[model samples]
Target chain A: MVQPEKARSKIRIYMDILQAVQDDGMAKPTRVLQKANLSHERLTRYLGELVQKNLVKENQDEPGVRYYTMTEQGIRFLQELRKAESFVSGFGFEF
Target chain B: MPFPFLYLDTSFYFLSGIVAFLVSFYAFRYTRLIENSALRFLSIGFTVLGVGLLAEAFIDTLSFFIPSTSSYLLLHRLIIREAAATYSFLQVLAYFVILMGYLLSRRGPASAASSNGSMNRPPTIGFLASATSVVLASRLGELGVLIALAREIIIISSALSMAFLVAIIYLDSTGYLKHRNKQAILVLVGFVLILASQAISFSLGIVAARALGFSEILDFIGTAVQFAAFLSLLLFLIWRGKIGSTGKSAQ
Candidate 1:
């Protein structure tokens, strides 16, 4: 069973991926794989979910060969995540 | 007024000494997270040796400033003996700790061919054994025997270790090795440099002990080379980002 905490952590991972892409600007799947240390299997599923949510878009013809970019919604999501992280850490609940 | 050669040497030693202390401090502070007990012990021993060498440098500087005082000379002798003894003991301890780590890192090779492979053995043991032999030879005080035996061992061990280090670095730089594995390579390179420098300086010390006019300059140069090597190793550790955060996450 996927625990609630594990699901939440995945959300954070998604944000981190987006942040890394934003920081590096146009990273290939291979680069992301190395940087994030995520296996291909796990990355494919999570990336697919993000595409479904419209938080990220896929290149039409290239499919899995596409690079990930954060949409406006994804950017907003990351900002909120950061705010929450700051608040929790300020309360001595360090991550 | 004499260009403060002594002051310059002492300052460099002090700076390197502080750097070593900081490296050890970081190691100890993050010890809970480090999975490798041998690396932890080696780090602690390196720190102790750094402190001892730093104290020895300070004593040498004092001897120069108070060169004519009988009491000062006595104090200098005492401190030098103490520091050298501590440094030697810590160095040997570090060698054993690193050897243990190398052994542990090679547990259970997959194939029989790879089981007794050269890579599985402690690469730095040769260098350490050479160093110990040189020190023992120095104690014997026989010039021909010391030079012949020590030079052969030190030169052979250093050349082999240097080649191994270069190969590892090349593999890592080309991305043929994984990130964590690259870290292990860096650690090995750091230790190899330390051992190599010590071997060179010990060899020089043997020659300087015999030479009459060049004794002071030789001693200063030899110590400076060692201090520089140690400092470089510490800096490499920092650059590799090995400080803070433990190996628990690594496993």
Candidate 2:
């Protein structure tokens, strides 16, 4: 059973992964897992959560291969993050 | 016709070296006053490069004063080329390291960990490209190959960095970014000029090699472009000092 705080952390990770994909274009699960530094065990579960939330979509053009793409919601979330970053940086808070 | 001695004058190198040293000194001093760790690291890096250039200048002067001294001439020739190449490589590495420090300082350790995955990717790619170029140029016995490879690295890195700086400046200038960080703009302009100089010098090198069969004048011009880059860095340091003092007063 995942704790509440851990669940929130996972969501944040999902958001970050989504943002990375959006900025860098489509990535495979293996690539995303490496970049996000998530274990394969954890990535499957987290990616499931993201797909359910419609923040990411996964597809496989061929068998035995999977690619992840950010959804509209993911893009919106990244924009919000950028705005927050700008807001904090403007105050010389250094994020 | 022989190229003018002014093209490789020791006095020119000495003047540029002194200016670079002074700028690095000021950068270090200002960083201490402002208590910015990133700037401090940058200052240290610049100081190293400045000292290297100064030594190169002294070696060149020695060679000029006694051209017939085979030992001095050999030492001078060896030092000038190796020092310049090593310093140029280090300068690129220093920029990447300083940029990493800046990002880490701005974003806390936790944020650094989070951002590291993304941020590290580009530099890693660039390093690979640079290393590959070096190896290939060495194996192929072609200075042009090396120059081309380095040019690609410098161009891509500088262009990306310039874009980021421009965006920051645009935001600040338009009053969207509330903080008045003109230092970024100044540094950006310096980077642009440095990039332009490198591009021009590299192009000239290729042209000279093809047309004039490797003239020393071409070599001097290449080095001159690097000296100009150091001057730009010095000017930015001065600008940074003024900005820091003003910010202090405002506080």
Candidate 3:
């Protein structure tokens, strides 16, 4: 029997949001929702986590409008993720 | 050094230690981010291997300063020979630890992923200390025969270790790991080259110091081949870092 695909890991989800913000240079919640392919609620929750970890910073450009920008720590985390990926891939395993 | 083997061996041990230390440093840093048990084990194993090489290098260095006085010369030679055994013991242990780490990775992904704890340190020190003592206390007679037997055993063990690594890596490529790409090829080539060097040494029966020049030449070639293997791994790690910085595929 085929097994269901395992849920994406937390680090992976972290990478997704970071990448979204990085790609946009500064991402809106809606833009990140689309880029990271996460539900609005899930994106909001993860963004909260990223902010808590100081990986991403949020700025309210105006009333009811917010943008998410990756902090230096967030950028470094993403780089670390990439390195882990490359190293694991060298052994033919998914990180 | 008076003996060519001592000179070549000193250089080999120092270089090997440096290479292993560098690899261990990278491994330890990566483990901090990944938090994989297997990665931590790898870091620890390489660290132990590096320390073993450094210890051997130190002993070889000390051997050079031994006085040629008739009274204590025999004792000095005995100590040097014992140190060689100690070095071999460490080599065997290091490879075994690294092999276990690789095996651990294969047990299941979650096994490595879930264990975010750091490597335990006390057991490592205790194990090394106890093993070294046992090797040191082991009895020996007739230095020439002992050296030959030690070399033979080391060559055999090294060959076996390389074989195990090759098999493990091959399985890694074809199994769930699916690493059958350029990087896998590079790793495989590196291991194979090292295996070949061990095989060459084994065939040469390099234990008896009869043709010291020829034996040193063979050993030099083996050391060079092993260095190349370490170089390939180093190149791969650097390339990986470059890929990481460029924001390419997370894979």
Index of the highest-TM-score prediction = 3
What fraction of the reference structure's interface contacts does model 2 contain?
Answer: 0.08
**Candidate 1 TM-score to native:** 0.45
Per-residue accuracy of model 1 over B83-120 as CA lDDT, tens digit each = 34334444544444434333432231122112221222
Error of 2 at B122 (Å): 22
DockQ of each: 0.04, 0.04, 0.48
Q: Between candidates 1 and 3, name the one with more favorable lDDT.
A: 3
lDDT of 2 at B109: 24
Q: Which ten residues in a row have the lowest lDDT in candidate 1 chain B?
A: B242-251
For every model in order, the fraction of real contacts preserved is 0.00, 0.08, 0.50
Instruction: Give lDDT tens digits, candidate 3, residues B95-170.
Output: 5666666776665556776765344452355346544444544554454455555555556656665666666556
Interface RMSD of each: 15.2, 12.3, 2.7
- Winner on TM-score between 2 and 3 is 3
lDDT of 2 by residue, A3-59 (tens): 342122333466457755765678888788877778899888888888898878888
Candidate 1: segments with Cα more than 4 A from true spot: A1-95, B1-4, B61-65, B69-82, B108-189, B241-251
Q: All models: lDDT?
A: 0.48, 0.51, 0.67
Off-target runs (Cα >4 Å) in candidate 2 are: A1-95, B1-9, B65-80, B106-180, B200-215, B236-251
lDDT of 2 by residue, B1-251 (tens): 13355336455566666765665465455333333344344445455445545655665555455453644543434334433344344445444544544554454324432442222233244335555666776898865556555444444543443444344334334332334544444444454554554454445434532554354565576567656655665665555444333322111
Give the C-alpha miss distance for residue B74 in model 1, angstroms. Answer: 7.7
With a 3 Å backbone cut-off (N, CA, C), the pairs that clash in candidate 2 are: none
